[model samples]
Target: MTNGDDEGAAGARNRTVAVDGETFVYRRFGGTGSETVPPLVLLQHFRGNLDSWDPALLDVLAADREVIAVDLRGVGESTGRVRDNVTDMARDTIAFTAALGLRQIDVLGFSLGGHIAQELALLRPRLVRRLVLAGTAPRGGPDFHNWSDDLFDTSCLDNPTAETFISLFFSGSTDSVKSAWAYLARAGARTGDQDSATTLEVRDAQLQALMEWAIPDSSKLERLAAITQPTLVACGDNDTMMRTSNSNLLADRIPGAQLRIYPDSGHGFLNQYPVAFGEHVRKFLGQ
Candidate 1:
């Protein structure tokens, strides 16, 4: 583990923690100022590794809080097979945090990560101080776990072409297009010791989890009431994958949850409006 004031997402060095003999690789950024505040743990979207995160957003959030981003088991530099269910993934996250000796934390999960985040909070309520879910929704919602062919066509492979990513994440607007390119550039800017892409086996496992998560028999929506933590639900108005309406569902189900929808943006709205979204997160956490 590289220590001592490593700066932004790009500057932070990778570290590992052994959880039940499996090594979990993650990065820690901006824990310098105070001990009163808990670290913010970020959960990535479907098929995302650590490098898939937006560096601009990470830097912005790290300004006020320590940020920890990790590759789940079998993804990127982490070891072990990817779990085939969200519950197991949540268990892994709990184990990872336990190994780090963190008693309390803030969670920000996006898309599939959001699903896992909900599971984590439900599975171990006291561990999470605050919750943020972006571009995601409660289980059993219409279109939940339904992936567009284009989306999988782009992300299911080891390496997605630039055009495929743009189509999957961004809207067609001129501003969205410009931001898409910029976000991709920043996400890829880290030069040394890059992580390997998601493997086909891992992707299959994740997809299976998503499919099972979407089953409506025992809806997680009903369980959202159990998640009494202060929550923030956000998404782009035009999010193609996870419909923006699901954001409303999340806010309505989780008591005291707040909602935000960026105008005319898509799945990657946070990247398009990083400064604004960053400020929102800071204010939410500060409260």
Candidate 2:
């Protein structure tokens, strides 16, 4: 449980709760400030589980307020069928919060997680206080629909190696790759009670969700207007997976949303710039 903020993410225990007959695994930690600051909920990328969160970044974000990182249904040790659409995923998350008795929360969604976060905020506006969208895009925006040929060539393998993730999240530049390896090392530092890997079912379902959600409809941008919560959109300067242009568009669409672009990074820029980005997030959250 990481009481008294002893060691942050790596030391946080895996907790369980039953939501609609589904046992969900999650890590809850760092709830150490005024009650006015709501907890932050993390939504992972496609095929990512609770362990997918970079410990360094988690520690940064959890410094003041509590952070809840879950394994979404059918991923990792969570017991349920993974859905083929973000709406169901969001619904599952909403149910999860109800089971935990959380009335208000802040959300940080990365990659495909960003999709679910958007729907969550829209569907349950009063529940979500603020939003952080990283390495993601809006519904039906440029470079949002479909995967690139390079991405198609690498993703959805039965087993993925460190190199597979390194290339997928960072650019091929010498520095970017170097940072990626460092991130891998830090993210893997948790020694015991680690989370399980996401299954192929989760992969296929998330891919199908992306296919349906990112179908480039400019008119859909109107949906962002409904998100009156303070928002922060962040990404790398060169995110091939979710192009940086999408960040610009996302921030533009969401009234008063701020955008940040990390230099010389890609989709995993938050991990690469954990210290800076974490501080930035904490400041934005203002705990």
Candidate 3:
């Protein structure tokens, strides 16, 4: 991932591309790498847009490879209403990539985007050259019980204050809480563009999806074995929302997948530790 300062100066050029009858906003940066290097496709988390990704992180990753981050449908500047579930969103991503005429690209997906990325690889294995799943899970199983409906309802639709988000998403530690809040304030201020109503709707729909979601079971996990691309599964050691064990399960289930655990961080590990996060991803893709 690229650093913030460098990203502001040299990140990919910004543009809007059409996918699945909808226009999506995307940023493309860095094309000076070796000819053999595939372009990198970045996927953002739930309710997040391209801007939600740290510019600095993007800059770092873009230093050696072409990086493209897109706004998923119903989020950011992309057109249409947000989908009600991850499968539909994943389909949208596949359509988005096909529309761009990309063949064999390295992909990094965070949180909700990670789920979608996995679906994309399962649905179209030939297109993904490498895969990274961060702060996410293979399925929305019983693990989501840690998050309360009230908390989910509160955090989803309204642009939550840093304190509120930290309380809900991070482990209840002073340092973690403080850092989470700070990151939230900074990221939210920089990337937060949700209106009250839109935020609320997005939140409600996302929670509804999660509350009703079920992992595709053994059959789906078996399908993951069909993914031939090198895969990395990572999460913060302290992520209360999605435990490190979840990432381990994904790694163990996916044939030849690598697992990385970031210490002293929570769900937003990428933002909390961008340099390390970018390095892990860069190395994975390099392999």
Give per-model TM-scores.
0.94, 0.96, 0.84
Model 3 error, position 62 (Å) = 1.0
Model 3 residue runs over 4 Å out of place are: 1-13, 33-35, 149-154, 172-198, 215-219
lDDT of 1: 0.85
Superposed by TM-score, candidate 1 places the C-alpha of residue 155 at a distance from the truth, in angstroms, of 4.2
lDDT of 2 by residue, 1-287 (tens): 43334668888888889989989999888865344788899999988988888888888888888899988888899998998999999999999999988899999999999999999999999999999999998988877577778786677778989999888888778988888888888878888779888888988999999878888898988999999999999999989887899999999999899999999998889878888998999999983
TM-score, candidate number 3: 0.84
Q: Each candidate: what lDDT? A: 0.85, 0.88, 0.70
* Winning model by TM-score: 2
Model 1: residue 49 alpha-carbon error in angstroms? 0.8
- Candidate 1 ranges with C-alpha deviation above 4 Å: 1-5, 33-35, 155-159
Which wins on lDDT, candidate 1 or candidate 2?
2
Cα error, residue 217 of model 3, in Å, equals 4.0
lDDT of 2 at 222: 92
lDDT digits (tens) for residues 1-287 of candidate 1? 32323668876778889987889889888755244578899998888898888888888888867899988888888999999998999999999999988889999999899999999999999999999999987888766565677666676767668887787778888989999999888888899757778888788998898888877643657898999999999999988887888888889999999999999798888888888898899889889
Weakest ten-residue segment in model 1 by summed lDDT: 1-10
Any idea what lDDT model 3 has? 0.70
